[model samples]
Target: MKIFNRVAAAIAAVACLSVGGAIAQSQAPLVVGSTLSLTGPLSATAMTHKLVGEIYVDQLNARGGLLGRKVEWLVKDDQSKPDLARTLYEQLITSDKVDLLIGPYGTGTILSAMGVAQRYNKVIVNHTLGIPSLSKYEMAFPSWSLGSDPGNTVPNTVFDAVAASPKPPKTVAIVTSKFPSIHFMSLGAREVAKKRGLQEVLFLEWDFGNRDFGPIAARIKDAKPDMIWVGDIALEGNMLLDAMKKIDYVPPIHFHTYPAPGPMSKSPDGNLALSMSIFEEHAPFTNNKVATDFIQIYHERTTKANMPDIAVEVQAAASYAAWQILEAGVRGANSFDDKAIAAWIRKNRVNTIYGQVRFDGPGNFGDDMMKVKQVQNGKWQMVWPTQFAAPGAKLQVR
Candidate 1:
């Protein structure tokens, strides 16, 4: 009788240990992968993205992570090269066996790496990089592709601003890099300009890696446009401004696809304070509690003295939002199978820092929420949406 009782107690102890081990395995960390351009022409923007991603992962881990599993982000520098991005993505999917994939800053990189993502059947939660065709692909694959479509958001903002302008420019000059990302931006911007009754005087494309804009400057001077639209990355955008100053070709309105007002606003000539598009999804100047909280956290982590500029702020928020959506989908599906999570993300409306987030049937995050922000008195002020307008934005001419 005594031997039997001892045997029963040992069996109970073994069962409890087995259950605890299973629980620990279930709560193990999930690994995620990223390919970013950390050392090339787009390095500055990529660095900002990296900082934001790091901060977000840190914060998420601090909060006990998502779905009972801490996230481990494995980031690789692609140096802004599409081929390198593809290689890194291949390695992450095969060797690292990452559970999720996110980022490849520019459109060209994203498009190139996406082929590998398709082959591996991985879920891609893009942070930035706007390729219009991605929407079409998502419709066919259903469980393969996903991301925000900046192409629609940017053009809509530009056209709306022009349509409402008190004295809209009659002639416009569109300048963009030949990179795949800016190509779409230029296409969208030109379409918007034409629809708004603005004549496109000069449509110029330059290689992003090229440092000299002298010829472009001369061409802009010759075109004598009433407005200038820039479709380049932040660094190239800054160089263009410098060239504009040197040429003294000041158009009535200077619009940029993204908010690059940081370097431009701080320029000795202050050439960037003209007109720009602040995607409502990425606008940091809003009174939204999420925006405020993100800004505070970003400032605390980075070396920047002031709050992160609009681009950095947007990148961080968007990256964090993507992570949250990824988590939601993972939890809702109750499985890490890429196909299941992708389907879940497509069907469900995710509440994120940005706002109520839901992808269209094609897996494209639609554009009803983009805010158009303008610079006034050396500050970025929300000019559209009326609900979040800054004090000086109300008086400024569109």
Candidate 2:
């Protein structure tokens, strides 16, 4: 990675702030920008991402800042719409002239931002997206496993665990939201179920915004699957669960890609749920000092801001990891230049709280760091990728 001394000359001279001061506009502050789903359907996940980026930037500033320049994160609400996200991103790159870019949540929003990023030749550090279509772009860096893992393996980890269980499920049902990433995950899970010799009793997909899942749940119940596999957002997952409970349809195992930790904990019978997540409060796979400090800081920040206590979810960690990677890349390249940072990321392996991180040429990280966990008696228990499982972490079949 070649280091360039271009940070000081990149932007106009701007004001800098003290530790507790406002992040006001500045000519020299390294501008990092994005459009977030702050007030729309994806707000549940995007809100956490917003806070994670804020905390990461604050921590960086406290540690002398990025390349000796303060960071100004320019985030706008996209209302969870692709068109709005695209417009905001174009504004960020052209009018706002952000020095660096971070992507918004979901495959749709991130895909909306990709064209703007490529048109401007800006490096977009993606956090919540794993769309297969985004692989062809050189400037996109996906922080999660969906991009790099073969056949979308991150979403298949739970199925792998089911296959390995002593009393493996004999029948499986797959249901998913109509979104691109969730659809892809469901497809992968279906293949894994077949390969494991589990009978595919039912396979169904629904529109993303459909609120009524009772009919779907009734269908699932009729199938009498030994296990139910779901791929969808947290909100939709909760909707489906409620529908399942409406008819008392509780399969032996209910595994999901969306880690609906909050709702799952509050459900009448939460323990039966299982999901793959990176945000478990004390997940062993990400128990390094950085991760520990992140948790502590996140708590302190939320408390200080008078916000509700929210557990660190995958969205927060993945969003924070993207910032960490950006910081590492910028410092390594010694330049705010997009091309330089992208090249550095390609040439060097960055260490993050997630693990020793190295991306494939297409900016996808290894899925080996992902963990499969199940809820038991209102607590999360690591149950897959046994090599990284925490003490006492094991699969329990009811």
Candidate 3:
């Protein structure tokens, strides 16, 4: 009887130990890390990404987190520098020991992070990587769903929309920032414009962070093309528009690549400004329950934070979709193993805020669902592809 009691006590002790181990494991926080241009040239746009991430993380925790464990996001500021981004990613892996990785804002920073992820064999989900040809990393996925060749696909999409307009511009002036992705897409736009038989009257380039837009704006005015493709990102586009306004000039049909959403919409000259978009806070785009809830929360949070643009546009949508992809990958893998998550993402399609995105395309890119948007009534509205346009919104050209 004494020996049997001792054996039963030992069995109970083992059971308690197993229960404690499981509890401790379930309580552990799953850390995900990334860098953003929290300061520097890309900060304005990157702030949108930051906000989206925070919203997603909050909502994630509310939903019991991933795999029944809490999630902690460790974000470092890369100051819009690609080199700094590379170093930060390394530190995130070795020192911070994050379980998952998300890429930064710009193409340069994303590419930089890509290298470190490759070295560590970590699955990286990125947004805003424009030049897909440069994205050869198999395990790396882009949330900027501009197809395999954004340089070609995005430009063609924009051109297709404009061509359908009542008075299509016969001449186009291309002014571009030498930022990696912007420059690549601008070059492709130039080729596409010429191939489509539109005359290129002016082709100008400025260094990535060039604040002096007066000269460039003056040159665009001189070219006097019927349309202008302004490949400026963040506040660069705003600065150019301000310069053009000083010269009392507004190109008849000016298109921006990645403008500061808020400033651009508020700028009086920004009305009728055209740009590309994946998702906007409008019908068709917001039909899904996930997107509907996201837009509502985004509105509430950004308004509270007093952000520049409270509207959900391409940039914000892309960032939100990236988190969705990561979450889907985690859930699909159902494991903390990085390789398994990557493999699951590669083999399956994940429904994102941007729609159903699959990574089977070239460079693991999804379909190019790029749409054109115009500033209307102090808000950005989808104007092209009739189906996705806001109620009664159509391409409005000057």
Candidate 4:
């Protein structure tokens, strides 16, 4: 009986040892919280971001994740509403207890979420929306703005486009949504136009969430400006196009804030002749190695061959780059504390699809590397910066 008791004790000890070893091999999963506009006006654009996040997390997990732990993403839909975005952000931080927070789809959404992040002292890596005012917010908290600042770059890009035009537009008509974010974009463009000796004809503003753009389109047609600039989100894109078609008003040159569906062949009219501030970090035209790899992996996972839209490509690359930055900081500090990670990210320069990304004192990647793209023969081509241009852009005369 004593021999049997000894044997049983030895077996139990061995079993416990094996269990402990298994636990040691498998690290705890890192939790990341994401707020997205999955089911509202911006659903299409938001879905692109969600897919990119999923692809990134999946690839990271396949490669043993960060710090030998798998990355588990917790995504919440904000319905493209700022109030809901704030609520979701609070839930993510307090209840989900996420390790990090990522900005949502639009500037307004990001602004709302930032309040929650600040209150909780969470580490936020923003990729989607950029407001010049973000510098002020970053100064107050641990946050990084990974996207281009529209207030600064949009005006510059607009001026550059006008100066390069064969016959610089003298009269310009601008239309924007009432949303503060969209209004700011339009304001930037207007300032640039005014600086370039362009006469402002009609500065029309309409409700963003409303469907009818007919009244605004009528006013734009009456202005009969040499150039028309559309500063609104994707939802507004469709409405504006439809309204323009009704009026039979086509300006000599049309500049869009976001990548126009018509330029990408998504819109049948194909009226999107010129685009400014269109994020193309992952487009094959750029010949970026990192971008190519990301696209290939994204397609492989989804089994879909379509190239990702501009926003999705940029957001995904930026978000993944943010993760790489965070990983470096965590490894450098040997801790996941928000302040440590923020300090590390601010000091280190990380590589991304958009090239070397390092925040300035205000937590902004202050590189003025905006590219100009135009639609010719139904294909969007990069035609600026001399290095990326394919036989310079030819202006289509009206």
Candidate with maximal lDDT: 3
Per-residue C-alpha lDDT of model 3 across residues 252-361, encoded as one tens digit per residue? 89899999898899889898999999988889887889888988999999899899788898999999989999999989999878899989999999888878889998
The TM-score of predicted model 1 comes to 0.84
lDDT of model 1, residue 16: 93
| True-vs-predicted CA distance for residue 394, candidate 3, Å | 0.9
lDDT score of model 2? 0.76
User: How much is 390 displaced in model 1, in angstroms?
Assistant: 2.6
For candidate 1, the lDDT comes to 0.67
Clashes of each: 2, 4, 0, 0
lDDT of each: 0.67, 0.76, 0.92, 0.66
Off by over 4 Å in 2: 1-27, 147-152, 303-309, 362-368
Kindly report which residue pairs in candidate 3 clash with one another. none
Stretches off by above 4 angstroms in model 3 are 1-22
Error of 1 at 331 (Å): 2.8
Candidate 1 positional error at 77, Å: 0.3
Per-residue lDDT, model 4, residue 389, is 54
lDDT of 2 by residue, 315-345 (tens): 6678888888888889899988999998898
Q: Is candidate 1 or candidate 3 better by lDDT?
A: 3
